[model samples]
Target: MITGELKNKIDALWDMFAAGGLVNPLEVIEQITYLMFIRDLDDTDNVRAKESVMLGIPYQSIGDYKERPNMIGMYKTALPKDVAEKMRELLQWYSKQEKNLTTLAEFHVRYEIIHPFQDGNGRTGRMILFREALKSADVDPFIIQDDNRSSYIEGLKEYREEQKTDKLVSLMQQETVDYYQQCSYFME
Candidate 1:
């Protein structure tokens, strides 16, 4: 869970990107991920520096500065304008939906269709799914474990090929129920 301070920091970073004219959602997501990575790296470096001092070892910082390249241009050139426009439309539609499992499933499928990033689209989409579920639904968010990869893929394929969300919805619902049940058993 992101603490209030970290969430505020992320929101500020997001606002900075938006103010800098990043209108593309994918670019925003990527830039936020980069900012989060940098923040985490800085935190880790601080801990390591302390450890090194305690151990009487020289600390090698990972905080080597690098020039920030024109990633906007690169991302703009990589993602076609039409695709970005379509993603914007999809996001707008998503914003209007009542938050629920069905809407989440639809959003996931549509996001996959957009496939905004060169890689990590599926992972990013699932992250969004889990976040949305946690914020809006009555169920606990569940991870799609490695053992369930085949069924998950099949569910996605079913949605893509046949416009069916039943499989995916069922898979997610079952996972949520099973996770809560396991938690309950452990608590007992």
Candidate 2:
């Protein structure tokens, strides 16, 4: 769970990116993910170092940075134009849909189609889907487990090719039902 302070930090980070002329929403997401990844790596390294000290073992930190030339240029070139506009349009359309699993599935598929970043699109889109589900539908978000990768990819491909959302919707619904059933069982 993101604490309010962390959320505020993230918002500040986003604002920093905007101030740095990253107006595209997809670029913003990608850049934010990069920053988050860096922070997580450092945090992981710190934890591992502490654990190693506790266990009296040598530890190699993951914070070894290799400077790459033209990285900024590469990123600038990688971000396509008008991503913010596209996202705004998508949000406007989504706001009209009934808040349900089906709508969530459709939103995820369309978000993939947008492909806003050079990488991390899938992870970011899934996060957005989960967040939206919890906020709009009042349900616990379901994970697309590793075992279901192929089916998930197939569903995405089918949607891209045929504009059909049934497979994805069914998959999401089943996952959600399974999650709730498990929760109920645990509660009982």
Candidate 3:
């Protein structure tokens, strides 16, 4: 259950995104994605730290500036030993980093393949990708609006599991570029 203060933070984040001139749904969703990941990791890290102290277990915060491998090791341990903590850490990192469109698309593909969260990962990943796209290029968010569920799932699966993000990245890049072109012409 989100406390009132946390809810207010989420609302404030949404408001900040809106005020940033992100008029497209994709932009809004993407911003939410980045913010959500940050919030999740920050909150989880704090909770886990408290648990560690209470249980007398050793725990390192992911944000600590240890070597990459050590940080990753700590991240892997972040998820409950009985749960999928590594995946959560991976997706959380993906949201915070600013990658190129190709990389961003590939990261999303890989992330979805892992399916870190128990739920809402696909939609959330897409939202994060769209939000980064908004920052990377001036365009509205694109939706997978077709009724063909197989195609959509397959598209993400190809990238996440099969290492086939080239096509997905290409597709998203083209769409963003096209949208920007349209916007530019309209403004002119």
The numbered model that scores best in lDDT is 1
Model 1 stretches with alpha carbons more than 4 Å out: 1-79, 137-139, 181-188
With candidate 2 superimposed using the best TM-score fit, by how many Å does residue 166's alpha carbon deviate from the native?
A: 0.3
Least well predicted 10-residue stretch by lDDT in candidate 1:
65-74
lDDT of 2 by residue, 1-188 (tens): 46699889967876898899987654554455457756765676688889999999866555222122112211221125555567788899998988887778888888777666544466667767656765663545665655787778877877777888889887787777765665453233
TM-score (C-alpha) between model 2 and the true structure: 0.55
State the lDDT of candidate 1 residue by residue for 1-188, as single tens digits.
Answer: 56699889966876787899986654565455556655866787789889999999876665332122212212321233455677789899999987778888888877776666543456667767766765664646655656787788778778777998988888888877765665453233
lDDT of 3 by residue, 1-188 (tens): 56699889966866776798876655565555567767887787788889989999777675432222211211231233423555666668776865676667667766654444533455566766666555665434544333544555666656545667666755675565655664453243
Q: List TM-scores for all candidates, in order.
A: 0.55, 0.55, 0.43
Better of 2 and 3 by TM-score: 2
Model 2 poorest 10 in a row by lDDT:
65-74
**Greater-lDDT candidate between 2 and 3:** 2
